[model samples]
Target: MADDPTKKGPADRTRVSTSEAHELRYWSEKFGVSHDELKRAVAAVGNSAEKVEAYFRDRSRDARR
Candidate 1:
């Protein structure tokens, strides 16, 4: 069967945490955004991966406008 396009893969998911250099580096590279951005997103929302992803998603949508 074909992959379910509606389901986001693990890589697309954001795992949030405070700036531990290696973890920060990992997430920054994972999301294709900088540490500051990720940190800000985590601050704005708590460190739930799904919330962080939604934060970025909303930011991206706003940016497109």
Candidate 2:
């Protein structure tokens, strides 16, 4: 089955669904970033949530320098 539109979060927690507004909101909130930032991260890396989170961690470290 497809994702439930009424769901608050993504059906698959391991991936980011850029095509879904709720997915963007959920991921952005979880990562404490804006929607655009999340989208950029997804694009730069891939849809893998683990990779996206790792990308943010790396970015955070880079920002500290």
Q: Estimate each model's TM-score.
A: 0.70, 0.89
Clashes of each: 0, 0
Instruction: Indicate which candidate wins on TM-score.
Output: 2
Error of 1 at 52 (Å): 0.6
lDDT of residue 65 for candidate 2 = 100
Please provide, for model 1 over 1-65, each residue's C-alpha lDDT reduced to its tens digit, 9 standing for 90 to 100.
Answer: 22333433333334565545656666667667989998988888887888887888898999999
For model 2, state the Cα shift of residue 46 in Å. Answer: 0.4
Can you write out model 2's per-residue Cα lDDT over 1-65, one digit (the tens) per residue?
Answer: 27677888888899988887777788999999999999999999999999999999999999999
Which candidate ranks first by lDDT, i.e. highest?
2
User: Can you list the residue pairs that collide in candidate 1?
Assistant: none
Worst 10 residues of 2 by lDDT: 1-10
Clashing pairs in 2: none
